[model samples]
Target chain A: MGQVVLKGINKFYDSVHAVKDVNLQIRDKEFVVFVGPSGCGKTTTLRMIAGLEAISSGDISIDGSVVNGLAPMDRDIAMVFQNYALYPHMSVYDNMAFGLKMRKFTRPEIDRRVRDAADILGIGELLKRKPRQLSGGQRQRVALGRAIVRHPRVFLFDEPLSNLDAKLRVQMRVELKKLHLRLGTTAIYVTHDQVEAMTLGDRVVVMKDGVVQQVGEPLELYNRPANKFVAGFIGSPTMNFATVTVTEANGSLIAENAGLRIRLPDGTARRLRGHIGHKVTLGVRPEDLTVAGAADPDHPCFDAVIEVVEQLGSEILLDMKVGQDVMVASVEPTVRVNVRDKLRLAMRPSSLHVFDVKTEEAI
Target chain B: MIEGAIWRKWAFFYLPMALFLLFLLFPFYWMVITSVRPDGELYRPWNSVNYNPFWTWNPTWDHVRYLFEETLFAAWLWNTMFIALVSTAISLVCGVFAGYALSRLNFPFAGSLGTGIFITYLVPQTLLFIPLAEIIRNYRLGDTPWSLILTYPTFLIPFCTWLMMGYFKAVPKELEECARIDGASRWQAMLYIVIPVAIPGILSAGIFAFTLSWNEFIYALVFLSSPEQKTVPVGVTSELIRGDVFFWGPLMAGALLGSIPVAIAYSFFVEHYVAGLTGSVKG
Candidate 1:
């Protein structure tokens, strides 16, 4: 196992800079995930670390040795591509053993490694079958097994579960987390799925437009996003945003939107002292808003009409319209509601996020 | 109405296909008939009065026997096989490497190199034979099978290289990339992954090179002045025509025999050949 340190890594394709000035330290035995939308250079960063792509400008060191000039083979890294890329002509056993054999390992040693990986992946019966004969999930395991048998210093996975069905993807995600724990090797995974990052990574790096927005533990990023992009990208049923102007109403900081007013919590108000007169964007997650009676004196509240409601057995997603903007609220599944029905909602100030309107930075 | 409509749909599908089959089969039938008939029946218009299309009174094996006995049929066959085999082997070796490079490498002006190879293929052998003949004579390779084997690749390599280039490109790049990461170098990857994956393309390209060298007439006719060194096409056509009195019997007989290997090769890998052609056209 080895730690990877990327210093001032920048990649450019002609005039278009793909990854810009990236510096990160991934500890040994740490699972770090790079998450972003397509073309955000997450995959490019992973590929550069794997030595598959050359760095236009930067230095990459693995276990305290510079590896920018090393070929992929010389770098001693294994990668699992999105398409799996298993050899179609070879059986699962041969596909997994190819890298070991290429490195001149003995036959008995290769067989032992192959059997161990297959047993770990639960694909012992598939050893004799060619890749083409296997299903997508089986091929994915074989691809993973191929990388495992190499026992490289680092494991690079580029959306390895993106091609599987939804249920299989979830199952594989759990398996991958367990596998990382078992191997205790440094793993750098790249994906656009935020849930995967939250579930798998010891540290998650959120990126946008080739720039790292924030890097932190999953809950750290979730609770304290560095910017607007990180805030919106880190959660599903995404955080809701509303334009509001902060005004001091009789000494209490009041955030006023059209047909809505929320009195800021004292701690949140102190953090926004410098931006009292400017327009700010108030952010709240779906699960942070609750259905409360109009006379509930716990926290600030709002009134909204339900536009749509989706019940997912245990929880419900309420699409409610307040004035002009629509926001989702997560509540108990048994909270019976209908379209166009007005309801009172209590907001939790601790869970609320505020960002500067012009800079999109957290305030 | 339902039965008639079903019949109409069946005919709509199979009618064009049946016509295509007959269109292709007619020429082979014509060649076989002409080869078997006597010299007198070479160009006789169909006789309606006798009403005999399948049956010919003077059907004989005279032409076939005369071809063996009169000319250097055996020597020409041997020379053609030798040149075709050598040319095909050399072309494949040169073409596969060039093709892989053109498909995968990102060197300076790689696109222009591919276009340069195809442009070389476009230069007709008939147009090139004069200068090539002079060069061959200067090198003292006149009337030698090596002349054809060496010159055949000038025509064969460019086209075969282009064919295999598109074939290799059609193979998923990730296959080789995965192998490269599996500790195989460029040459090892080509040997273990790219080549095996492109077997069908190479086989079709090989068949093309062989048939081209076999049927080539212009360069063979111009360069080979001796009957002993001439390939099948030049030897058969030149030997069977004596001062405008064409030896129709042995000429058609040799023509028939000369086409056998090409025909068998065509049948052996027809699927791959068609796929190769389609791939090249797209690329």
Candidate 2:
């Protein structure tokens, strides 16, 4: 019963339009993530859904009821902040029970819910300890426990795992996914880390400059990005892009520049036919580029010189120079490569991406 | 602690520390010694035989006895305590709310309002007392404990407000936001989350306000002219000394006794006061 719908959501701070028109429909029990760089309006959109920020001109409804004028307390939602936001003076049990008490729950009911949440969070033994006495991970668990005790209709998270160390962040991300599955509550999470969005979200929304760029399942975004920003933002090593002029040769389109040349695959060539003799941006992921082999003769290949090699244990990342442009390639760890080595790299023909240079949109 | 050598540690840390301590404690040492010294030794010429101004051979409680039994010193002590406590309580309540609003609430001119309050504190009390005296006479609160008690907050509220505003700003706004999202109203969030977290700041503000009102002099002297209504600072200075003849023993004893309460207050909350100034919230 937690279906949330937003229509034409916008937020303005004086003259600055912080969040532009955004419309989304979140299914019940679904986990959605909003991700972008700083000031990209992801957090602002979440806050608007939570009723913490006033929408400039829009309608937000939870469970099929408009909540535009409702206060946060009446929104029937819970939030986990980045800093945990535990009450410093209260014990863990009291912290978990505060919401229940405010809602006028009976004494025994409050106790039962508090203890149940503590057990679920594996913090039953820490009920009497204050927040300052707990470690960071333990405090984070208490924050989650506090949110779960109320059994709110929705859960909002604003960069909740950003404060943890790298290892802890990964562990917490798994726990968060498990928690969402068990609770079956609608959750909206906002973060700047694409990896977190990819791992935890059923669907991820990509935004830039206060505008929604793309919205779909995580794999859809990785497989088919709508624009140049999405392709570069979703992957770890990032997609390499080069501006090349589209020229027709032998009834096939060729994208060539001072640094490299590539034959556009059949599907991309058909869409890019009208742009011949005009400059178009070519994009390819690092994993899609590899050392050329005999089987890759039909694929587009180019010459490059290795500039730097980074050993990542599982794989090696080679920063190579192709004429004036620099590109990176992820190859097998056993491959022996060094700086200034001349190499031939091949791109998977089916994986090549081309974009209109002016619009920066996929072609 | 200097890292390398023992002499570097001593030269850089211990030597300077000892000298600083001696320089700071010299006045208190003089007060304590003079309060207990015999009147014969206190007024004697420094050039006389067996005249050691630094140390006294025989100590007496006569000066202390004179302070308590002969004059209106006990009434002055009671007046000062009552006035300081009442004024501090009034100032703290107003200061905490004012500070929270000025720091947390987004309103028109909030920044300038905070600065304006601080500017009032910077106005010297020396210049303020004259206009205040005229107001006090018109209100007919002159020559009573109410005069000092009411006037002290004129300075105390601004100081307490400015200190508390800085302290409230240091507390994370996320705590209150989380509380609100967790089903608490704005007032409830402030009471349960913000006020408890701001206890150290409140205590530091209370301690400073109490100390300021306790030692306040110009207002006490101008508003309270009667001998019985005067506070410790006014009574000890005007009553203990006659023209060209300073009562050294009784005067020093009164000074020594007057400072004990403030000293005790500082030591009692020294840890919290330092933490308040440093603005440490774990989150």
Best candidate, lDDT-wise? Answer: 2
lDDT by residue (tens digit), candidate 1, A1-363: 579999999999989999999999999999999999999999999989877789999999999999999888888888999989887667899999999999999999999999999999999999999887899899999999999998999999999999999999999999999999999989999999999999999999999999999999999999999888999999988998999889998888998888678888888899888888889988999988888864347577888999888988889999999877789999988788998999888888788899999899998
lDDT of 2 at A16: 90
What is the per-residue lDDT of model 2 for residues B1-283, given as tens digits with 9 covering 90 to 100?
4799999999999999999999999999999999999998988888999889889879999899999998788998899999999999999999999999999999999999999999999999999999999999999999989998888998999999999999999999888988898888888999999988998899899999999999999999889988999899999999998887888888899989989989999999999998888887766
Provide a comma-separated list of chain B TM-scores, one per candidate. 0.88, 0.98
Best prediction by TM-score: 2
Worst 10 residues of 1 chain B by lDDT: B274-283
The TM-scores of all predictions, comma-separated, are: 0.95, 0.97
Residue pairs whose backbone atoms clash in candidate 2: none
Native contacts kept, each candidate = 0.49, 0.76
